[model samples]
Target: MGNKQFSQAQKLTILKHAKQIGPKEAAKVAGVHYTTVYEWKRQLKELGEEAFLEHQPRRSGRGEKEITPEQESAILQVWNDNPAFGPGQVRSQLRRQGTTISIRTIRKVMEANGYTAKQKQNQVSAPERFEASRPLELAQMDILEVTINKVRVYLILLIDDFSRFILGFRLLEQTSVDEVIQLVRRAVDQYGKMEELLTDRGFVFYSWRGINRFEKYLENQGIDHTHARPHHPQTLGKVEALNKRIKNELFGQEHFSTLEQAFSALTKWVEHYNHKRPHQGLGGFLVPAERFHGQEQKALDDIANSRDVTAQIQDIERSIVNLVLAPDGSVTLYLLGQPVVIKGGSHV
Candidate 1:
């Protein structure tokens, strides 16, 4: 793959002499490799000086079939209409739309027709590594910027690194330590605690007050906690990529009037994102949720059990008081507005 520089006249002389004489004697007179002289002779005889400056034709084994200009224009129009649709999806959809074209043909058409894929480019230039081998092993948390009423609102995102699933999110007025802590607690309470929590060294994440509380709580629960290197935001690429997609799909090209509106919209979009949106990172463009939680066959009884678990979260907070269910199946009410820890049981 490396190139050796040679002057044009030297190259031309080498070719002329090598073709007239034998390779070995020509190489001896030219003071170069016999193979090099033979290569130059063949290139000059077949391709002339252009071969010296440009790459030789690669052996593709078989030539591609020709596609009509109309087909190419159709591909371009479809691609331009849906900016997010990549070649594989476009090809599949084109086939569904009555086009008998392969994905490879679509890719070739994309290249020839100047419809290149949109790459999500980051401003920063560095590689940050974070690895989670098993599902629920680690979750990366971060905040992204959004606008509501011309005032910026922060989107708190928690993503499972292994599953590439946006675990949970909340649109908050500010990136306060308390808000992050509360969201994290809600996530752990809902998803069963993760083994480790990874976050960048932001003010909310690195504050001694909040960090101490989180470290103490994680230690108590035997969970590992880590901080990404300062200034290296790419350390949490999964969360960052999720934030990008969510922003575009939910709020792109639209302005929000209030945080409430943004939050409600985001909640709806998140549900669709987790349940319906096909992911390019996951092979064959499968839904992240389906891949994260295996698409196993569930019976009717299993469906009911899932509904029961979900009904726990839908309990009306307004109709409920601070009451605990004891291990012996007894109910005890605590003083309203008092901060008391309710251990290992639901509060209503």
Candidate 2:
């Protein structure tokens, strides 16, 4: 089986050559293995005329084709759930769902459906080596810039490295140390704190001088703050990819008049991303919630406290210097969230 498969004419030539000289010497001259010549000699001995011919009989009753309509349906279901999943991942999903299919079959099914071009990208670059073992064992945080209807937005996102869960995200008009700290605070307060936080060496997340607000907040909360190597976004693969998709799906779709509006919309989107969206990283069957917590999913009420957590500074002396209220007695006093006050000056 390891021999270079030769044509019928080539096989006959090799046998004739081996007969004129010796099998080993003929194999050496032909640049083929001695076993190859010996095997051809054996075939010629057994089949004589048929040995050199190309045709072979069909294989015995190949049990109900390995790939069936039912199996194709299962493969399609996996693709529908997560189009980004490759054949290996599809095989993994099939195994988990009590079926075992080869990667070749999965590719065939996907390719038949015209999905191979997208799924089969050149894998010339080194693959992502970083991995997180559990929900809060490690988390990745990053900021992305996106333009929405010509208005630029900065998105601060925190994702659980293991679950591919968007732990927290905010679409803001600008980036600041305060906003990033608030983002981390929201993640900690809701997800019960991650052990380690991975991020790029941005001014907001890191400081060349001893410590910054984000670093200080991490120390206070007992979360280890780690920075990705300068140009290595693959170190934080989950959040980096999440940011790209968010820009296309959320920021690309809507036009927001205010940062507050973007924040509210992002909150809803993040909620769905965590609770509803299935991730191929988690085998295309489980959402981030199901991956993080087996059989349990976090409700909107639980994670939605990010707004109740804080938007900005709250003290009247600190934040109300430029106080202005709408006719409906509504005002956003803090960076934290929309804190409304009545005309009489009491909080609504």
Candidate 3:
């Protein structure tokens, strides 16, 4: 059986042909050497038809030292019991149990044993589009539409764009100019006037005819103002972001039939947003109020001390009377100028 290759039918046919005819002619007809024909003839005579069959050779290398089915099942069982254990850890554990296997082989075993790799599902929503550079440099205001007792109501929200601070907010039955003006005055009175107030070009903001009272008041007080682009609510990104959070995270499930209930809920939510919640935009994940006015207040105090108080006061007084007319019909007039009559109206 040492490299003596021949098919069983072929060996039988060759033996039959060799017995019938001469070996040389049979070998030529069988398309084999004359020595092969003689060897087949001798095998058929000594061992009969069984000599045509073959047998597997015995292995010599570390024959079948690989892991058994039981060992593979145990590895999978350990993986199922301890999901945190990866292939390498499972392999190490198997080694400790006297079952030697490479990590790559263990990985293959795990994959075959229902440990198929799958990608993680991502469902987290994306963050807002806009961002602020500095604290209190910009503020966003928005009016949210909601229903109270089946009647529509608007929630006027004034939020600081930079620090995400809810400066002032009010719920109104109507989106009237008076309501918005009151909210703006409340914010200004509480936290000194802001440098810039960013808002959307809503009817309340544009005042229907583009005669924005809020903008006019801010201009009168020398505060910069801006309105968001038309139909682009994301321009006032901070307020819009806060409104969404309030609606979803805070007031999503709560059913409030009264304005007072909504106000109370908003108060609590605003407190949480200002003090408890950590803002990723702020450094160290600090609260918006803390970063917006905390250190800046101290710095402003230090600067205020060095600034000339009298000159500042005089400059403010002068600015107030910059639009006033003098008795001689002069455009530039001070508060000390005498009152005059211009077209039957008093001007001081």
What lDDT does the true structure give each of the candidates?
0.62, 0.67, 0.61
Clashes of each: 0, 6, 0
Tell me each candidate's RMSD, in Å, in order: 15.7, 17.9, 27.1
Among residues 3 or more apart in sequence or in different chains, the pairs in candidate 2 whose N, CA or C atoms overlap within 3 Å are 310-336, 311-335, 311-336, 311-337, 312-335, 312-336
Selected candidate, larger TM-score, 1 vs 2: 1
Query: What is the full ranking by TM-score, best candidate first?
Result: 1, 2, 3
Per TM-score, the best of the predicted structures is 1
Compose the digit string of candidate 3's lDDT tens values, residues 1-348.
Answer: 122344567567777887788775886676654545554555566675664445222342322234455766877775774454567656544543445556655665665444645567796665457665444456778898877668788888987776687888887778876788788788767665666778777776776665677668778976677877788676776677778777765556578888888889888778756653445555422445554553324323433344312112112211112243436775532221122346756443
For every model shown, what is its TM-score relative to the native structure? Answer: 0.55, 0.53, 0.47
Write model 2 residue lDDT over 1-348, tens digit each, in one string: 123445667778878988899887887776665545665666677787665465352442331123566777899997787555677766655554556667766776676465644446677787557786545768899899987657887888888887787777777787999988888887767656677889999999889989998799889887888898888778877788898887777777778777777788888777756665546666554557655653322222222332211111111121212233657876544221223456998764
**What TM-score quantifies how close candidate 1 is to the native fold?**
0.55
Candidate 1 lDDT tens digits, 1-348: 122345656777766776678666876676654445555555666676766546433443332244555676677766775556678866533443445456766776565344556778777656755566444668899989887777877999987786676778878777777777788788767665677889887777766554566566667876677888777767888888888877776678567788887888788777655654445565433445653453312211333343222222223121122344667896655332122347776443
The lDDT of model 1 is: 0.62
Ordering by lDDT: 2, 1, 3
With a 3 Å backbone cut-off (N, CA, C), the pairs that clash in candidate 3 are none
Q: After aligning candidate 1 to the native by TM-score, how far in Å is the CA of 273 from where it should be?
A: 2.4
Winning candidate number (lDDT) = 2
Q: What is the lDDT of residue 7 in candidate 2?
A: 65
